[model samples]
Target chain A: MFFHKYKYGLLQTIRNKELTFWALGFTIILGTLFYAAFGNVYENDDIFEAIPVAVVENVGDDGFMQLLTELSQGEDKMLVVNKTDREKAEELLGNGDVEAIITVDESIALSINSTSDSISVSIVGSIVNEYNTKSALFEEIAKTNPEKLPQAIEAMNVNIDNVIKEHKLTDAPMNPYTDYFYNLIAMGILFGSTFGMTIAINSQGNLSAIAARKCVSPAKKSMSAIADILAAVTIVFACSVITILYVKYVLGVELGDRLGMYILTALFGSIMSVSLGYAVGSVGSIGEKAKGAILLTVTLLGGFLSGLMSHGMRQIVESKVPFINRVNPAAILTDAFFSLTVYPHYDRYIRSIIGMAVITVICTVAGIIMTRRKKYASL
Target chain B: MQAFNLAFKILKKNLGAVCMYFGIFFTMVILMTKFNPTDAFTTTKLTIAVRDLDNTTASQMLVEWIGENHDVAEADFDNEDEMLASLYYKEYDYAITIDKGFSEKLANGETDGLFTVSTSPVSYTTAFFDSQLSSFVSNVNCYVAGGFDVDEAVSKTAQSVTAAADINSLDGNEESPDAFEYYRFLGFVLVVIMISALSAVLMTMFKKEVLARTYCSTVSDTKYVMQVILACSVIALGIWLFIVAVSMVFDPQTVFSRTGVLIIINSFVYMIITVEISVVIALLVKNRSAVDMCSNVIGLGMGFLCGVFVPSFMMDESVLMVGKFLPAFWYNRALEIATSSYEQIYNAKDFATCIGVQLLFIVTLMAAILVVIRSKRQQKSL
Candidate 1:
């Protein structure tokens, strides 16, 4: 009897339209939002653009061209400004048009002139500052000892010679792209639909209340458990597919890595949500309170832990309880996307699949235990 | 006053939903601040490429000192051009090239060598390299003064000094933090976006089945409109204060004092913007689902484009320019200037420009709302 009621409850939820609409709507909205939110830190634009520095050389020697050539490469975009002389370079620096100006003194040591106000430019100035340091040291040593100048210049020449031979490495990660909203939408649709479906289950099949009524007639316990699990899984999978499709098509959020992983992760995530819903629905006397509490908890907890709340709160969580980042299913899902995109070798993706799977099982068992414990009052 | 009384009555009648609305907004505030960490720790030796010209004992000692103190990345630079190229591009912060006169110059009792560091982290990077250079130079001077072997004396005299900041203030709370940009004022933006949406969603749910009966009869349209505006304004102001206060709770610097006053003003401007959005949802969309959909369209959509949910850097130039037109973006800009020392670069007067733009949006949106409401009433009367 319990088996029939549980099985029937799952089918009725499948036929519900209102819940389906919300699930899809949320999935699209959340997915798009999520896709935009994460991956933003890395602005994927052209690389190798040099900080535009105005050069003012009293010598006008061709040697400086080598420095300019090495820095700018074939890209004219890097060194956007090359003033004719010091006066122009200084003018541009004073006006803030140029980030920094490199003025070479008669002695070969360089000096960087810029309004000290800009920290980023000042840092750029430091690199220029080093060139001055080199020239000054070279001039001072050669003038005093003369012998060391040839050797030092020779070493510098050799270092320059090796530039092409030596490999330059940049380990900047690939765009750690993710959308908070997409994940939120995906999780919310799964969770919200399942929560909504609990209402459907009660309205359609008074499964728990009717279970005890039929207990006297006769029903196997194992069959009852199977029915409940099957119903919840069916509801989870159906809602997940509709919501996932809406998330993909309408919102245009990037779905990374294996499509199978996304479905699998969301499935377990939904099972947990519904299992919690079932546990709450098992509150016999006042179902509304249970429903409200369950919905509120799912949305708030999911939002808070997963950084759906805001950057400020996310910062606080990361600083104070960084581990909350690990446990959050929404965080797990989003991180998995990032890992696949950025850290192809990162362990987080594997962890997400395993963690969510474990959670699904736990939720399923809890839902079964709570829903089937035979509401003492109903008995 | 009558409008306010009506609004108060409506709100009083619906407290549970109001809390839920407030709860989500508050949670957004908490989440935004929590996401970024304020940590100050030393990273293990950042690889530094060295091109020793002299290769003398003094030069070797200088290189050895660098290896001991910092992770000196052994990079081969056959020439000055290669080293300069790498430093300019940030492959290395500072590079050392020992000039030819090193042994003779040191023997001559003059401390002269060149240390080059980029301008990017001029403060931290310059200070660090400066200290190391000073120590190495002083050791060379000592050896020259006393005819000492460079390596043995330099290593023996070198002291490992660690820097510690006395951040425990009189107020007991630390001001700002190390790596101020790391938290990336962008977090605050995410908080405001989520808050506006959450508040809108929660507020939407307040339009229950029975409000239609009250909305249709007895209450004059003037009273109804006035009451709604009043209720929204009050709720909006209340939410604004709560958000600002919560913002103040973290980032105590620039968040309080005269800056806090600026935040208080901008908070109203922003919350009013949010409340107007919420009001539109309540007036038009009766269904919870519809309300949520509309709110997401305006709140989330605008937030996405306007540098709230995502930083403007990630946005396309055209999209970012469009985002500049939104009141929320300007409002946050006002808050940003008020709360950070960026006010030093672009002061309060500049921030007022953003405020001016935001006001323009409020007026425009309010005007649109008024026009819609007036047209709806005329249609009903006809």
Candidate 2:
């Protein structure tokens, strides 16, 4: 009997095309937009190619030539030197073929077309500056102690390595771009709240005409509520899963490797969202439009707190008033995904799942308690 | 005048919907202003964890150097997995391990293979570190090849790479002190589109259901249509004024500034265009649910493609091509001009062109709506 009721409830929800569109279609559209906007951002940041430099060898200095050869002839080459005369180098700069022209005479000098900041040009300029300073230093050192040059070179390399080593600390990579997708999934789940809200409205005797008709039936109010909520959850869960699959496979977003964990988070997230909606619907005496306003405020505010607006908001909340993360359903859903993908352990993920489950139970119980004892004045 | 009064009464009754419009705009403004994009790059500092497995003089020196700009911390962990766990939880932004004989390898002047690491590549620290390493290595390699003594090369290479040029801006004074441009576009577009569209749908829908009752009344059809439009326009105007007032509260100087006044005028023009489009949408869409769906699609789809949420430069060429047909594209173009410093004669011309294009869209959509409504009325009379 419960299965038949649940099946009928599911069909009613599917028939309501506008509600289904908001819960499912709108989410897919927004998800695709997010994917398009932030997809290539991280990959482009991590890769680099050899910087092209126009080197004008005016004096044919053997030492400088050897240095250029050594730096430019390997797999991880610093530069791709374009050996040219002064005239051609100037033309190359004009045509934008090279970043900067290095005039290798007594002192290394850089010539370029404009001061418009280009990373490659800045690098070339720095290289030229370093070489000139080194040339002056080497001249002084050769004069002071000609035999000590070889040992001096080794010492300089060690010091240089030490200097560069200070800032290059890195190990476990985290892509900042993936946070958008995580927040998007969180949003899709929270949208399930709207379904819960409408279900609660339609099932409560006083709130809706349909619920008033059902109230006259032989089945218990709590039993009907359960069946209705179950049907709504099933529909919402399916939509959320489809959104996840679309994002992961169709959009090609890397949503971690653990499919089981993703499914678990989505399930719990949908249940919590629906219960919240149901509670809001049952507890309030307001109309459908008013209930919708409340749902929008709660979900959008929750999304904002969970870093839907900007990526750093989550970190800010975590650092200050972290209890908000513990309570905000949207934040919890996002954190579950964050833990699965970014964290090395399941501790945070488990905590989020448990938190969602607790909220769901509380909301569902409160909703039932509020609606179970109904004395309808109308219908 | 009677029709006008009745329409105004109806609008007053539905002020709840107007508040929903205000709520959306308020949320958007607050979100855009509070969570600044620049904070990620400018304000935050990277925390680096050093795992000096070598424990040599070279490794220690490397760690010390990394400490110069970054907040260096010791990675107190049992093994690689534990160290990575710290990194994953954002305990440290970066982690590095200096290999054994790193000093010996460097002193011997090897081209590569000194360390292993992972880092937040997007951060300014990574770029600074990368360039510094390249410059230093090249200098050392040159000094050695030039026959400089070991002690002299170390001192000279360190002194050689000191930054020679300080960056100076060409148009530094022209730049706005606070980025008001980024904050303005979303609210104006969202509020105008949502309120005007919803009002038209609701009013037209109400009139359709009570067409026979409305005919029984004294007011003529033309006067009744005009009054309904006038009421919606008044409501749209109220929303526009509210937004302008709010913007003034946040940035009084910008709101009263000459450019701010120009932007306000530009927004008003676009608001009218949106109203006309909304009226046309009411004529086309039959049901309330369809109206809601239409509003959402138009609001979000046009908002994105027309550079309401995303900047115009970020949008693809194909998307922009489609967006050109919409009034919002022109609206954003005019906004772009208004927000930017009016330094050139071309800016004034571009502003006029954008406003002109918006007016053209309004005329076209209004014409279409009138034709459709006339045919429907004729069919009803038959």
Candidate 3:
């Protein structure tokens, strides 16, 4: 009998494409938009490459030439030195093959393309300026005090291990863009609450004409309510899971290695959202549009607090008024995902799960109580 | 005039939704407009773990220099695993280990003894530390090379480093920092308000039952649309004026400037484009739920693509190319001109071009919506 009600509830949800699209389709579309917007930002920020420079070796200063040669010969080479004639070097600079052309005359000079303000140009310019200043100082010191020459030479020759070591807790590199996707999933879960609200309204006889017939049926109010809630959660969870999979596989967003944990968060989040919607729907005799407006305002406020709009907002919230993170359900969901991805342990992850569980239980109980109490005198 | 009176009545009935829209948009505008991401470059201090194995004056000086800007904690770790775990758990943003003989290497003018470990392979903090250490070493070398004694060189170098100033100017006559902030966010505020007000007003006028009654009236369909458009325009203008008035309370320079007046004009053109789009959306959507979803998707999607949320410079070339087809893109282009300096504003060609493009969008969208409405009406008459 429960399965009978559940099947009909599932069919009802499938038929309501408006609710289905907002819960599932809109999120997938937004996720793809976010992916396209932030896909290459992570790689560009973290990756390093050699800056190419054209060298017009006019005056051969043994000391500066040795330093440049040593810097260019390493695995993590500072510059990709292209030793060429003035004309060829000018051609390279004009063609944008190299960032700038360096002429080693009586003094080190750099000619940068006026059109480009690239990072390589800045780097080459700074290096040239530093070399000019240092070499001039060395020449002055050598002329004044012959004794300090050995110490200066030794300082210049000191080999530094310039390395950037990855101390990752997880194998996945941190992509700052993933926060938007995390928030998208959280918003998707809350959007599922609309379906739950619809179901709750449909089950209670006082809410609508169709629900009046359901209330008069012999299938039992508690049984039907439970069946509706279950079916809505199943459909919402399917939508959430499909969104997660699409974002992960097709869009190639790195959610995390813990697929099971991600699924668990989504499951709890879906139940919590549906229960929240049910509670909202069961209490209000308000219009569906008004109820949806309330839910939107609440969820959007929650998303804003959780850093859906900007990445730094979450950190700002964490720094100030941290209790909001503890209370906001969207934040809790994203925090669960964040902890699983960022932390080596599951302490915060488990806390988030417990928080979501508590919310789900309370909302589900409240919805059930509210719907059961509405025993219509004339229905 | 009667149709307009009817539009005003419909708007009055839906005043609550309009208020909610205003409240949300204002809250978002206030919150986001105040945050300058560039301020974080100078103000944000990451916590770094310091393990000073070398107990020398040079190492102590380095630690002191680091402490001036960062929250430094002394971490004693037994193994690499523990260090990695602490970093991964976000106990510290960075870890720096000063090995023994580090001071001796610096004293000898050698560069190789400091080690930094962090969860992030690439970090600004690490780069900052490297630059600071390099500068210190180079300063010492420079003073010694200039024939100064070791102690004098060290003190002179320290003093020179201390005297560095912070002057970061990108260009001359830059927009008032706060003015630019508000101007950039105006796109989002306008999108939200336009969608909410336009959809609410038009949706009420064209509700299935309401439209049937309206069709039964003495007025022709063309006059009805004209009235609806006029009423929406009044509301749009009111919204724009309110925004301008409120913006003036914060940054009068932007609102009162020559560019500001141009922005106001361009905003009105953009509003016409939004009204037509909203009418089309109201006609297409079956219910209030679909209206909400449609408005959100259009408002946010266009705002994001057109440089309201994310700066246009940061957007992918393909996304930008796609944005060119959106009215918001031209709106943002006009906004760019409005926030620019006198030289750019004086020419006014870009402003005219962007506004012209937005006007073109309004005409096209209006024509399309009219056809859709007329066809639907004919089918209903049959």
Report the error of model 3 at residue B343, Å: 15
lDDT of 1 by residue, A15-123 (tens): 6554654555555555554545443342332122346667777766566556566656663333454755767765665455565555554533333331222233433
| Reference-based lDDT, each prediction | 0.51, 0.68, 0.71
iRMS for model 2?
A: 7.1
For each candidate, the DockQ is 0.06, 0.19, 0.24
Candidate 1 retains true contacts at a fraction of: 0.04
Off by over 4 Å in 3: A45-146, A162-170, A282-294, A369-376, B20-33, B37-56, B67-113, B123-129, B135-157, B160-178, B207-226, B247-250, B337-353
Error (Å) of candidate 1 at residue B337 is 8.4
Question: What's the best-to-worst order under TM-score?
Answer: 3, 2, 1
lDDT by residue (tens digit), candidate 3, B1-382: 8878977787777677678767766666667666543311122355788877787776676677667656886455565544543454345667877777765655555555444455455444344444445655676765655567655655555555443222122233143335555656666666666666677778788778876787898988788878887888898888777877777787786678776677678777876777777778878776776777777788778877777776665567788798899888888877766665211233478778888899889889988988998998899889
Worst 10 residues of 2 chain A by lDDT: A163-172
Estimate, for each residue in B1-382, the C-alpha lDDT of model 2 and write its tens digit: 7655665665566555566656776766566667444211121245787677777654565566556545876675445544543454455766766667655654566646555666654443455456555666556555555564334444455655553522222223243313254344542455345444445444553565566677788877777767766766676677667767777887777768877777778777877776766676667776666666666667666676666776665556667787798788788777767766222222788989998998888788778878987998899789
TM-score of each: 0.62, 0.77, 0.82
Off by over 4 Å in 2: A43-150, A153-174, A284-290, A343-345, A373-379, B5-93, B96-116, B120-128, B133-206, B209-214, B231-269, B286-293, B333-360
lDDT of 1 by residue, B1-382 (tens): 5545655554555555555545654554445445533222122244566777777776677677677756675445664433433443345655556667765655655553443332222224533454345534543444334334445434433432222111111112222331123223332333334334434433533344334665667877567656655556566566556555555656566565676567666666665566555555555654555654565566565666666655454556666576676766686566556644222233868778877887787888788768866876688679
Give DockQ: model 1: 0.06
> In candidate 1, residue B49 scores what lDDT?
65
Model 2 lDDT per residue over A1-379, tens place:
8888889989987887887888789888877766645555455333345667788898878877786887689886767899999888767765557756778776666665432124555555555555566656666657776776665555445434433343322322466667777888888888889888988898777778888888888887777778888888898889889988998999998877877889888988889999999999887678998888888887888888887866656766876798998999988999898778766668778989988998999998998887777777767
Docking quality band of candidate 3, CAPRI definitions? acceptable
Q: What pairs collide in candidate 2?
A: A149-B148, A152-B149, A152-B150, A166-B65, A166-B66, A169-B95, A170-B95, A170-B118, A170-B119, A171-B118
